[model samples]
Target chain A: MVPLLEFRNVAVDAAGSEPIEGVSFAIAAGENAVFFGVEGSGLKTVAPLVLGLEEPSGGDVLHRGGTIRGLDYLERLRYKNAIGYLHGDYGLISSLTVEQNISLRLEYYSEYLPEEITAITERLMAELRIIDKRTARPVQLTRSEIFRTAYARAVVHDPELLIIEFAFVDQSPLNIRSFMDVLKARGADPAKSVIFMTYEPQKFVDFADTFIMLYNGRIVFSGSRQDFFDSDNPYLVQYRSTSLRGPMAIS
Target chain B: MMDDERKTTPSGGSVAAYVGAPLLRVWRGTVDFAAYVVSIVLSFRSLRFIRLRSISATILTQTRFTGIDALPFVIVIAVLVGGVVIIQGMTNLPRFGIEGYFSNLMVIIIARELGPLVTALIVITRSGTAIATEIATQKWSREILALEIAGIDPRLYIVIPRIVAFSLSIFSLIIFFDTAAFLGGYLISLATLYMPVGAFFGNLSQAFSMKDLLATIVKSMMFGVLIPLISYYYGMMPRSKSEIPIYVSRAVSRTLFTIIVLNVLVSALLYFSWLE
Candidate 1:
């Protein structure tokens, strides 16, 4: 069976910086892949490529064995609708209230009645504990509220593939655990595939089935969780010890 | 290295380069804007697929902001202009032994020229800058990407509503401005010049032709389209937060320039039959 998502020798060029070169990976259905990279490691670029927001400068990004680079307008829309993306910057529309932002997709595309959309939105808002801030604009919300709101919007439709970038980096341990629990509950569906691009690998070690580490735009390691823990890769060693001295330069 | 480069560079080449670069950029910008307009036109086909409820809500909000909220200011400008035109015409036309054409002068100045132009100026100052800044902010915040992720086309949701609202709002505002100007002109003349209300209205009725009304409509519609298109084009060009203000300033300047040009073009076309 084809993997749910695949990156085939994908090389993305960044202006005035190192380019992500000769990268290859895949995630099968129901598998969880966590990507950990230092800041400026070009990990953030992967999300836009997968979301079709940016095309790869070389190679291809395949969604279920089909190239996603140049799908026509309707095909692109359909592809996007199947994936749930939580952007690193918390991409919430400032003009819209939290409730409006959450229900935007449903109100626009879903065949559900208005009452049903409201009900679903309410449930998600309540789950994320942002029900009280439903009527507030994004500018009025705290950073945590913004993250929760973005998270709720991303998962509101229960998409097949969920790609979350740089989420929960600054959240309390309790909040991260709670969000992980929510992710765990969602993962029980068996067909859900998740790719998390983050800076903190240790925080998600328990949740990830596969761990991929990048240094200076190249994958330093990719393996199962058990192998990841057992390996003596210098980057892994550096990460585990939280040491300042390592092969991977801090800057 | 700097001295070597400077030694190799010719003064004439530098002058040509300095002049050619901006001209090339302007040419490129014109081509890009033309392409953007074409894309907007093409995206209209997808309007049928978009939800009408969402479109209507956006249009309503835009109309309230652009048209309804502008009423008091528009009224003030109209009254002042109307009174001044009447006062000037009364003082001057009689010297030419053409005092009977006061109403014609009013129609020519207010309805044919100032109504649409003033309304457009107001809109460009008020709504055009707001739309550009809002879209630029949304882009800087990654909200446009968010819409794409959610499978909603920004063209349909953002651009179309603003286009429809600006057009409708400008059209209505021009009509309101003309009416208020005529009424204000008549009242000012009645109080100061002692002109009979019947004669004032009768002359105006004769002077106000269907062509004047057509001119106002045409100008408003054209201004409406130009403002939003220019604003959105600039708004979507910025790549960073610091660039938002620069892009917005460009949007305002471009919208103002385009509206004035379009107004003049429409007026000349109607009056001189230049296209014919």
Candidate 2:
């Protein structure tokens, strides 16, 4: 099957920083790929780029085989509807109530008046198990509640490709499964692709179909999860040495 | 020797990397601000419903921003200025033995120049800067982008309301300032100068003219539009993720500069158009 998204020779540079140079990666229609990198690495750039918030300095980001560029409002809206982004920090609004926040993505597609918004938000609130906090703002919610609310907002529209950053925990396998189950319940297609960026490999190792390693803004490895686990190449050795988990897990 | 060379090379590389990117970002920000303005105009036509919704919200929300919140400072400044003007007019008039000219001078200067200009200046410093900072922070947070992503144009939603609200606020403050200054002048005349009430009232009416009134309104309206536009332009211009904080200062400087230039132009126009 054709890839849902492709980042061809993706090169990004931010103000006061060197270019995150020459990175290439793709996510097929039904794959979940996670980028494992050390702290302060350039993986954060991928989250905003995928969401179309920042135009790449030197690269083509193809959505469904067409170069993502110069789309009119309706077409751009269509693309955004299919893609859900949770960019760690740039993902949620704090002043709006939980219901208002969750309904933000859905408000574009549907002509939701106050009543309609309230009804749909109430449903999502219940499903996410934060119903009592419907009127409460994001600042009032705990960190985990904020993440869950952000996740609820991302999936409330039922996006096909879900991109997450700084999520998943190495110490909580059951929690990871529970979270994936919640996503599945929310109509996130088991066949739809997911790209998560983080430092912890074991956190996402069970859920990810492919593992891509980024070092110094360069992709040093791209392969199946098993190949990543099984590789003893010098780059992989170096990654293992730096990782919190010194020994790679065999599935 | 190799170690020394390695440290120097990395340090130099870091410095070059840091300096090079921001200069390019400033160029990018200029281009981006232009594109945003153009896109705003285009999208204004395309998204009427969203614009209407935002406009209504802006009208309702800005009552506080423009009216009630701005009241106290507007009154205080106008009153203090009126007192200063009367005291000076009284002092200077006695020297010329034309003490009666004090009320005429007070009404003409306050209505023609001081009232509208002072009101606009206060609103620009207090509310205009706040509006710019608010919009800039919204840009930084991706709230503005969220509106765009949702097919809603931000200019109508964000900037137009501010323009309208600021216009209303400045106009109202000018009206209030004119009233306060008159009262202030009257109170001073009665308490200090022992000027008769009927004479003061007669002088105030004689000094008032249709041209002076029109000039004041036009200048105030121009200022209302100028403050918000300059603030929004500078606030929304910076795209660099790091330079977001600099937007506040840039907004202030740009607004102040634009307002001063506009004030000079309006004053020249008033002098040429009305006096001649």
Candidate 3:
């Protein structure tokens, strides 16, 4: 299968220093991949490459075999419309209400019919349990509610690939779990792909069909969840341990 | 991925290089800012515009703040300015017993100068702060990047509506201010002195040239664009919350300075070419 997104030996100079060195990874269609690492491990830095917002210093970022960096203006717009990205802080537009914020993607791209827009709004609000808070602005929402709002906005278009960052940190675990479950279910459809990134992965580990672990700018593991859990790799072992003092955490 | 892309900065030990570094930085910044403003202007070339529905929604929302909410302040200032001009005229012109000339003098001062200048300042104080703070907050929050990722150009959704709204609002306010000031001055005259309203009207009618009206409007519209664009430029500069307030302060001061400089320059040109 052609992967939905692939990074080929990508070396990125993050903040004037090369923190992502020769990292290679591929996420095929329908695979919900989780990437986690300690600070400076470069997991959070991967989204910009896939989003075509950044170009790799050394290697290519490809979307279904075509170079992401090569796509022109209109093409890039279309490509981005088909993919959804959720930042660590739930990148909601402050000026827009919760519903306007969610519908913004559809309305901005000029893609939805009035009724289709109404239907999608209803469905996402119901699913995300934000029906009551639809008119409330981003500032009015609680932390958990904002998570739901961000989730609704990201998936409002049924995007082909969704890149989510900090999916579980500071979130109510139940809410994160439910959101992850929905994403996992969506990922079972052959047309969709998910790349989830986080600093703390243990709480949301159950959502990963495939797991990729980064250690000091290099991918130490990229494979099935079963394989990752079974491995006795020092880094994996340290990461899996729940103890306060572990090599997985920054010293 | 972007981090890999490199930028070369100029640095050297030679005497010329030592003197030129700051100058070089300023030159580069000027070019970059010109390019940014031009790019924003170019985005309006209809062929490149985003959905009209999006633009329409944005324009309406922007007008609410720049026009509707600004009406009260515009009115108060207009009335006060008009009264001040008449008060000055009433006290001074009666020595020559040419108090009838108050209408003509008020027309010149209020329409040709004060109308556009005051309107621009009010907008800079009100809409300019809001726009600068809004964009700066958005930039600080990474919401602009979020918009880009969502397939919306921030210029399309953010900047263009403001430019159009400010221009339209200032033009309207200039007309409104002129009307209010005239009526305000006339009311003051009626209360203070037994002047004939018809004669007052006749004097103003005689003095009201299309050139002065045109100059007032052109300045207001130009100022409308300048104020918002300056605010946006400064507002979009900072990446962190700590830097946003500083940018907001800088946006207001720089916007005021630019408006004053441009107002004088344009007025001088108009004086030479038309108003003289």
Candidate 4:
């Protein structure tokens, strides 16, 4: 079967920074890929590229063996609707309450009755533990609450693919684990693929089947979970090290 | 000799730059605005894809904000303006023994001119700035991107509802302004000029024409479309927080200028019998 998403020798050029050169990856349906890198390693570009928000400077971003570059209006809309994105900033509409924000996509696209939309939205909000804050605006919600609300909005439509920017950097490991558990429970579809972009690899080690490490806009390592931990590549070693000093330059 | 040559060359370049830059910007802006209008028009095809419930909810919310909330202010302005115009017409027209023409003056100023223009000004100052700032904030927060990611077209979800609301609100507000202004004029005449109610009603009915009504409708609708479209265009241009205020200001100023120009163009066309 064709992979659900693929990046074939993708190179993205950024102004005032190094180009993300020669990046290649493929993710089959049901497979979860985790991308980790230090700040400014071009990991942030991956989400936008896949979302078709930004075109790669070179190479193709394919969705199911087809190029997503030049599709017409309706085709593009269909492609966008098939995927869910949890932005790093949460991307909640400030004017709307949490409930409105969560139900917005479903109500807009689905043929579901109003009652059915509400029921589905309420279910997701409850599962995400944001039901209590359903009436509150984004300004009133805490950081984690915002994340949960955004996550609910993303998955409310049961998208075929979910691309998440792991924003639990300051949270504890237990909180991260619990969030991961919720994600797994909600997004357990065998045909649904996920791409997790994070700086903290250990927290998602158990969740992702494939690991890809990026350094200075290039893939330093891409392999199975075991191979990722076992590799002694200088960049991987540096990443694993707690010290600031390493073969990889911090700046 | 070399210094003089350099000075002359630089001066010539500066002259060309000063003249060429603004011309280029105007050309680019016109092209961009045309493209934006086309995209919005094209997005109408996808309206069926959007849920009717969603579209109606958005339009209702926008109308409430743009029209309902603005009622008190619009009434106040209309009343005051109408009283002033009537006071002036009464004070001067009777001196020339043409006071019978007071109703014509009222129809020309209140119905045809002030109704649409004042309402348009009110909307530009209120809803227009709000739309610009709101869209800028949404863009800044990536809410627009979120909508796109959810496969909800911002044009359908955000722009169309707003355009519809702005148009409807301005159209309704113009009617309200005209009614309130006439009422204010009558009250002013009753209190100060002792003009009989029957006489006022007779004069107004005789002065009013289909042409006046047509002018008011055409101007109000034109202003309505231009205000939101211009504001949204500017709102979508800013990429950063610091640029929000600047773009909002530009949106307001440009919208104000466009409304004035369109108002004149419409009036001139009507005057020249080019439009009915």
Model 3, TM vs. native: 0.90
Docking quality (DockQ) of candidate 4: 0.75
Candidate 1 total steric clashes? 0
List each candidate's DockQ score.
0.64, 0.14, 0.51, 0.75
Segments of candidate 2 deviating more than 4 angstroms: A9-25, A28-30, A39-42, A54-59, A104-110, A167-181, A184-192, A216-220, A224-251, B1-51, B54-59, B90-104, B132-157, B194-213, B233-250, B271-276
Q: What does the lDDT read for residue A169 in candidate 1?
A: 59
For DockQ, candidate 1 versus 2, the one ahead is 1
Kindly list the per-residue Cα lDDT of model 4 for residues A80-187, writing each as its tens digit.
877988967888999889999999987786789999999998988877777899899999987778888888888888878889896664555554444667888644
How big is the positional error of residue A186 in model 2, measured in Å on the Cα after superposition? Answer: 4.1
* Candidate 1 error regions (>4 Å): A14-18, A175-178, B1-20, B273-276
- The sequence of per-residue lDDT tens digits that candidate 2 reaches over residues B1-276 is 698897767576788878988988878966876786676567666554452443555565675777678898888888888878877787788999987677667766787778877887787778777777777777787767656554445676667777777777777788899888888766865566666678777878887777777777787778777777767777786776667568767777766766777766776876675567
Kindly report which residue stretches of model 4 are placed more than 4 angstroms away from their true locations once superposed. A14-18, A170-178, A186-188, B1-13, B273-276
- Kindly report the docking quality category of candidate 2: incorrect
TM-score of each: 0.93, 0.76, 0.90, 0.94
lDDT of 1 at A70: 69
Q: Per-residue CA lDDT of candidate 1, range A1-251, in tens? A: 99899999989885744478888999898888889877777787788888887777888999999999768777887788779998668889888899999988887766778898889999988877889999999999977888889988998887889988887756676654456667777665579988889877776666778999887778888999897789999987887787889998886
Candidate 3 residue spans exceeding 4 A from truth? A14-18, A175-178, A242-249, B1-29, B45-49, B94-101, B273-276
Considering chain A alone, report the TM-score of candidate 3 relative to the true chain A.
0.91
**Tens-digit per-residue lDDT, A84-191, candidate 2:** 766555445554678767876455345667676668777776776788888888778766676677777766766778887775432244433444667654334565
